[model samples]
Target: MAHETDPVGDLTEAQAREELARLADLLDAANIAYHRDDAPKISDAEYDRLKRRNAEIEARFPALKRADSPSDTVGAAPAEGFAKVRHEIRMLSLSNVFEEEELVSFDQSVRRYLGLGADDPLAYTAEPKIDGLSLSLRYEKGALVQAATRGDGAVGENVTANARMIDDVPQRLNGAPEVIEVRGEVYMSHADFADLNARQTARGGKSFANPRNAAAGSLRQLDPEITRARPLRFFAYSWGALSEPLAETQSGAIKRLEALGFQTNPLTALCNGPDEMLAHYRRIEEQRATLGYDIDGVVYKVDDLEYQRRLGFRSTTPRWATAHKFPAELAWTRLEAIDIQVGRTGALSPVARLSPVTVGGVVVSNATLHNEDYIAGRDATGAPIRGGKDIRVGDWVQVYRAGDVIPKVADVDLDKRLEGAEPFDFPKTCPECGSDAIREAGDAVRRCSGGLVCPAQAVEKLKHFVSRAAFDIEGLGAKQVEQFYSDGWIKEPADIFTLAQRYGAGMQQLKNREGWGEKSAQKLFDAIDERRVIALERVIFSLGIRHVGEGVARLLARAYGSWDAFVAAVDAARDQGGEAWDGLIGIDGIGTVVATSLVSSFAQEAERASIDRLVRHLDIQEAERPRTEGSPVAGKTIVFTGTLERMTRAEAKAWAERLGAKVSGSVSARTDLLVAGPGAGSKESKARDLGVEILDEDGWFDLIEGA
Candidate 1:
């Protein structure tokens, strides 16, 4: 690229054309990485720089604008897996500028087009540009009709079925326009992402890279039921096209969306000028990391509808809006040391202790080095860095904190090595227990040979046994469990059931301990007693076996249906040899590692005895199967709508499902019946039009026999 000095600030046509093409290519590449890969090659600042450059080039060379330029585009090509749905109205992209000079230039262009001057200030609406997938939802007659993913601006993928699964996407509108097209972003909550990844890893599947990717992948699943299982949320940001005018201003349009039961982004702000826009951008950026979900930048749009129309668009993207991105959160820090820590599952991970540094507002001291290869910073270094090789005690290394939480060492600065800086020596024996630690073939984690005898692993197992999603002994939290372990009241999970028997007289002594009282001690005992008859799935999860999570435990419980059957299967699995174990592998959702872990856990005589002892005093309840008895809706597909007089929609669905019916969200030809309630709208009409059976609250009650 060449630069031309023009004192008069006029660009030559050829120069402008070249700049525009360069900017388009840059933005295209950035979009591909961000949207398709869930990874960005450039920082938000860099992307904004390139986008602003494109706008400047376009401004200077109006005639040289390309039809396919990102400056004139909405989003990248439609992602795979979804059925393409052509947007009723084109979803236009936004123009962008970075520096104050570029923003002023953009403002000047707007003013010039409107035949106004600098003194004629423009008002704008600024909102956080959520780092998520954009979607367009269409409603007909106050009912959700269609939902589409924002594909290449002109067209998108129809995802109505998947969209219906999203709880935040209202099925029916309240005070909605006759026909409205609301645009929003579907995002995954941080907690949801963590849980989803935990389940994924527990199933021996690769975890999603981030929440945005997880949300997109979940939404685009072939099975709508799979998408429904995910914790995906949607927030309306802007409008695509409307059959009827919603509101005069952009803010008003968002307000109307909220009125229609759509969840709008609450961080939107109305600003009177550029200064206020910048202020809002700064405020949003400052609180970005704390927001839970990711946001790359802030979007500023012209508030007035007339002004936006007057400013118009350039081929694809609208000139009425610009994105103000936050500065990059990436930083470099030295890796001080690498320490191996064993998890509850006995999997050891190398944690990098970094020199204290701030990245995206939060102070990060430690970064996960992943495994031995990560610690050694090489592939062939069989000797782990902590095991006396590769990365030394004094070596400069690069660190990164992606979304302000996960700290990771990115690279090593070998040139900054100091003389006599000894290579890290990983202990040959368990740090917490003096036992031979060996790494299994094809496994990076070095396991404690002591197994149940290792104090560290034992305590971790006990903690897992009483976790909230497991047996859930109410008064026996992690802290209390640790205290009881230290006090010799509990040695293992089985010891928990015997606490009252072993410490009945010692309970008075525990009452006098700090934070413990007579009532509290009694409460702990009662809680333990309450959990003596835990559900089969809870018992399976509470066993604290490696590679088994709540979902997997439920799957196992459902497969076996009883504690004796499950135990027998596990015992049989061990004797069946590799092929029989491989036969167990083909079971739905059960992978080789999980199957192997199941068999291996049972093979240990000590662990088996512990489990037997624990269950000796406790009763393992049989998992309850959903009843699909002789209800009218049983074996029928039903859709519930509006407010029910007898029960909440959730309760009604549960009851219907218990009777063996498939509950659908929308009324379709496949729908055997539609349970319409008060204020039912489009679903009622659709059912009536399609000749699908429609039952009112009273009629439904009479049919189900639960009225």
Candidate 2:
């Protein structure tokens, strides 16, 4: 392979070797930042361009391929934290095909490697490539015993507890081998990601830039209980360390896993040639948004298992498979202005308002500028970076869209800047509250000193507490939350719980007041009443404390078990900052920042009083501890449809699940039980037809109550 216009062709052998070494070190750092830290220092296009340059150099001088060259590495080495699990078989990565010609080359290379004639038949299964965290689950005697991440190809971090929390992951396989490892990607749905971010934003928490990062962050949570609270799902695509062969074909193996109670991608299809494979890829790309989950590309693997064995493997990727990724849409646009938006936690975020331009069919008008250092072209260490140039208004900036959701500034053209353009000066005071904005040490954000005093921060905190993710009332929304705040109907979170008690009986004053109606007011009170009882994690997160997002709140709730225990622990750690403080900070996923925030919030007399008032009006339930082992109905999918004679539908569902069975709403092929009552309908009929066991109300009581 050669390029007629390759830049590296001009360099001498010695110069080429030095440049290759430099590129090798640069790419290694990028891989670590991307794969381990869950943060990418550069755009995907920039990374690919650099890697391509290195490959060109390596091709020109094959003898000088460095021993530590990134070409031989699939991903960075595992970062320190969890225990490392060595893979029994290497979990190799897939070679990527960014363009149609490269995809054609991949097919040709595979055919050439196999010594196949031009007319020979070649079949492959093209699967939608999920943009998520790769996970490997090992099952022994049909029971999931351990799970690990795709850390480096040879070794991974143990994440069995976190993996078990995924609803799609089967806790135990009933119909198969004694030992097997199922390989899959754990991802979050677009809807779930939006909900989580909305809650985070409402509570003044940091929102995820994209769903891929959200899924990765959720899975890598320090506490498994936190992972359980996250809406993460898995889809089995391949396997490792199998005690017995699953199927003779790649597609057949996927079907087998689906039958074994595992979720599999339905877009997977059989392709006879590269044209057919590319057609399927295009079809998937068209339906990407409708699919809900994120997919970066399409993966083509040889259909026949025997052919894969014969084709063998490379050091980092398989010889029989390749991933064809869709190109990111990029366009050059002018930076019109920079705006500073204060978040609920008072962190200042710089947003770049851009001249409208379309990228990948979506019109993008704004992009993130990160922070002050990013705008000034300085790194975390304040060293001049970003090609030794700073971003300013009136400069021509290149932006790219990834998955059509996150649009980022990829590069800047220095020559296209206006003659009199000046750098953006970040504000030193909050725009909404006029408070002192100070940048804390080791932090990228500049925060406002005013806590509850800042209206922007306070309203954001209130919105977060009642946002769809927190106390989520039916009739309440952002508009109503702001309206109520403006009218002084609700001053604090506790005031919401007390609204009906104070206003319900006073129709002349409450319901008949300005902007209030009798029906709407009663509905609001009913909604408030409905939320008086909530789970412990919900209340903890509703407090709107900095760094205590949903995941960390679950970790705290699980550690303390109940609200009383959590409050007591914080109170104990407040004055006596020794073992108690250490214990609070020792919780996984929590650092010094979160611990200090908790203690400080409790120490505030006004904050403590507000919390006490809220606690008095609410009934908070303790979160259940995770039970991954020793449950009779643990992995079984169950459904209870129609009316129940002995108990309500919710009660039956909860009771059945208490014994360890997974309670599903609908009846499917995998359903293990159907509890029916007088009006047993389609679900019961479907269960009977599928041969699923059907138990009546009396029968269910006998089985559950007696046990």
Candidate 3:
């Protein structure tokens, strides 16, 4: 509630107490929104800001700290459904190393604790720390009996049946201890995650945000069949409740698990000392995107089991282990301009256009300002946040991407701000529709208040309809698309198909238009006509339903197979709250939120009429099941970068997609191949760092032609 001027020292004890109370309530709601709802209302940076405030108040008023103090808390309480199982040995959290110096300090502390001389060498095993759900498997006589989630580090949800469905989780192990508990991570590979989301959308369901969420949602499924349907994998990392010693060292124990038919990370290696540990970390970081799964950090454990025992445990983590994480994917960039975007839901979003900068190997030129409050450096109640610093044009700003795929400005550097920079005054009217932008009660975003009538909403939706991943009309980019809409040549998806009939019949009509000759006009018409026979997935995506993304669209197409089947299913599933609502809410990834959004879209008479009009104008094709059978590029993920010499990059992507390969914009562990061309930048470097197979324009042509 206070500003930067109200310092911690200046806060009266009562004021500090009040602030703590407000923080606790706010944080509790935020945790619920993030953990239970899977719909986070605030950014991670904002949450951190609040948590820091809570801690500051507590520090200033130690005697006034509440029994439910947030400093001691981790995650929220678990949702009901599964039975709870208390952990025999607490599955603790890990201390983190954000910088190289912190890692060095950690190593020094370990050496000091063990009383080992500087010359004396100690080995530590470095393992890629999977970013997924933590699971503990209790085995008796080498037979798995129970599996549980990490709930508050003390108790967890029992999901033994769900665990059994994971092929990576061994049912039985030979020549093992009579009793033992294997603590490991449960994750979904990037490939599996893509497949899962596609499947979810086929059934008219919501798709998971990331592989970690997909894995967690799958493992936590109430129905064992749902879990079985998902591709879940496990990696054995640590242990608890062992009846007999497994090995002398951490790396050896991992090998023992591997021998016992448990999956352990192949990259896990024994390092001689701190320098070796840091080197391994770098090596892993370089290879990170090629691992086929998500790893947030690298974990280093004292290899010697005896030294580990001597170091013992901290209050919440093992003293012998520390996790070295990448610095927050953040960078400083100049804020060049601000743009407003109106979403399908009518929410007006403020976007920041920045001077090109790299954050986590991705070149970002735009970041989200989130809302007016964020722009004003205030909370919802107009309280100061971020040291009460407001952002302006020509200001040096920090941008970061964490859990979100979008970049967000973390803060502004006032010292680097240019003189005469004006404080951004958020507009009160929608830029697209010229309607009043209204902020509703209890909502952060300012909405256009102009529903379907707003041209901005209509035009934005139309733009998304023809986006690269959607219909991808060859000659119809955003600029052309918007131009056509404004000029009344195209108004809807159906209008795009009827463009030639509407204007092409007359030579002077299109050819005589400003900036259009016979050749270019005819090319645009041909491009539009070429896409008349469209895949069902593209059709679904082009509809521009909120929350029903490409993955969800693909899933829907897959489930229904045919356009007719999908239309009928959605038409019949009218009541969002009814059981016939896609019968999809219970499906992994799709859940209630996604299902409701989808059903609501179809429930609108206007939307249904529009879909019908579009359907009648095209030859709709059924979605084929994933073609992994004998396709050479099947299930492979590839990236296209730089300037291609032969065919265009877009053509290369189309070829890859046709061959059943996933065409991604960024290089990650999932990337199997990288097609680099002249002027290739970050993606190429990252691909090389990830050990992804590099292909020239010629090589790509050969790979596709040969396939």
Candidate 4:
């Protein structure tokens, strides 16, 4: 780790430690303002100046280097919602150089490290640095086996189930390597994000802060089906551990990846020298904002594999590559006012009302308040703060918008607080229902105890019951549901099914109501009629119980097997406390909070009555039949790859499941069948290595059909 030009090499260990600590503090402050707050206090020029000074100090005092040094990191900590997955190979970050002089210096360093003279030409690859999450996908014999996020470089979250939903990520590869790891960026296209936010706003749901957050949220969803719905795309950029080496050059590796059916960024270009690299970066910078997807900067990597190996890497960053980030997008606006709102789950949220300002091309008027602690700046006694506080009535706040989407407040200038202004007091009761609100210990949210009695909570619950992810009563959109509830046409979820019956004569009158026409009213009625029969999983999720998301709903459906049995168990858990409920908590992955939510939701007399009435009007469909008997693949894990000639991939999967087979996306020792199609690549080879049975399309048809 030692270097000849280290500046801190001459300083004592104590002095080096002091300098390192100062660097950490400065970088941390910058990171909070830039990454978390979205408002950067310093200009890119000034920040780079400070960053270069720190780098010099770190280079001088290598002995005092900290494990989590800002200079060596790529991104912040992996988000909290997803389960952590340790990376098979560390996803080290890249260093950064902003100016052309630094780029030339970087090129010279690469040549010098490789023992190349000035006359010896050097080449590099340049690609747009995607403003998205970094991920690693592992393939054994060409079949995707594991996918993980770039957490702390050393560790990441296991998003294998969700990754399977990305269409670009082939389940199997062609012309497979024995073992390969592909690294890429996961992002949502600009158009898709816009559409998604539009739908969210129309439904009265909170829109995503930006494309990056939307992509992150969608990818981490528990349900594979939900992830599949999001328009997420991937662009393979690098590699990790491999059983056999790739091509001799970085450009060659990318070409090979493209041949293997990976989607590589078409913008990648090979540069002969630092000057060429700078030229390419400048070209990309000129078209940055109009590129459709967000690009924070350009990434440059040495083309020669040998040179990259020779340069090696630091603990968390490669010596062969660097990210040349674009300048920050910033703006200023007036803070008009602050408003507090409640959520479906009863959490009180503060929202900032602002004078319309454009950042990254989108006009923004509001920003999140996070919580009550962020507003008053003190506890009940006006003590000094420890955590975030709510924004006051007239505080000047910095705003930032990225990727032409939602704007967020970056920082508040308390010095500019209006004269004689008083700290805003948070409501102690639910605004809509007057119920006592409780801020649970260890939780940041304050929730209403009124449950179904609260109008806001009730309306939100009814909306969830008929949401697209739930029972999916097509014509029962959020606005329609709200109006129905307010008009007493629907009082509970069960009331939805009996609406036509209860208001048989009034149905004609609905056309006369505000926002309702004859065609719309008829469409609503037809939609309600169409959903009289629902699958078990949908019914479970549509119940609007807390923590019962799509994944949990499916798990419950499978475990209970029938609606009656599921209802019985839920009722039993409510009646016979402790052990009965603890048994639910004992199920791996189902925690106390979820178990309690389920039991509490069903325990209420009103909720039970609604369920009963709904069941009376609706027909609960039987679960799909399991895979056929005496089949060799029955109860065994199967992975399908490539394009199928006999049927669509979805159709093939449905047929397989109907016959009692357990299908998975990746190859493992447990895999019994690999039904590979025409272009079957990696998965087929991985199956060979694992000694799993490999079936061609005809062979699969023969086995399933008993031919």
Alpha-carbon local distance difference test for all models: 0.76, 0.82, 0.81, 0.76
Query: lDDT per residue, candidate 3, 91-173, as tens digits?
Result: 77786777789888998899999999877988899989887788899999889999998766777789999999999998998
Kindly report which residue stretches of model 1 are placed more than 4 angstroms away from their true locations once superposed.
1-328, 379-392, 402-405, 577-583, 625-707
- Return the number of clashes found in candidate 3: 9
Error of 3 at 426 (Å): 35
Instruction: Give the distance in Å from residue 619's predicted Cα in candidate 3 to where it truly belongs.
Output: 38
lDDT of 3 at 369: 94
Judged by TM-score relative to the true structure, which candidate is superior, 3 or 4?
Answer: 3
Clashing pairs in 1: 72-316, 72-317, 386-425, 386-426, 387-426, 388-425, 627-658, 628-659
Tens digits of lDDT, candidate 4, 1-707: 21223355565667667666776777777755543333455544455656676677777767667886777764445556667777777888777786778888888888788888877988899999987667799999878999988866777778999999998899999786889999999988777888888988998887876677677777777777888888998989899988887799999999998998999988899998877888898778655544667776799998989888889997667889998876555444567777767666766677888754434534356876666765655454446453444456776666765554456676666666788766777888988888998987766668888877888887888888889888788778898888888888887887887666666565677778877777777777788888888888899898878788976776577556788877877777885466666666665447777887888878778877777888887788766545446766667678999789979988887677666676788999989889988767677778999899888899888776761
**Candidate 4 local Cα displacement, residue 651, angstroms:** 6.3
User: Model 2: clashing residue pairs?
Assistant: 202-464
Off by over 4 Å in 4: 1-332, 373-390, 400-407, 419-421, 575-583, 586-588, 625-707
Q: What is residue 637's positional error in candidate 1, in angstroms?
A: 16
How accurate locally is residue 706 in candidate 2, as Cα lDDT from 0 to 100?
A: 36
Best by lDDT: 2
Q: Model 2 — which ten-residue stretch has the worst lDDT?
A: 1-10
Report the lDDT tens digits of candidate 2 across residue range 53-90. 88788898999999987778877778788889999998
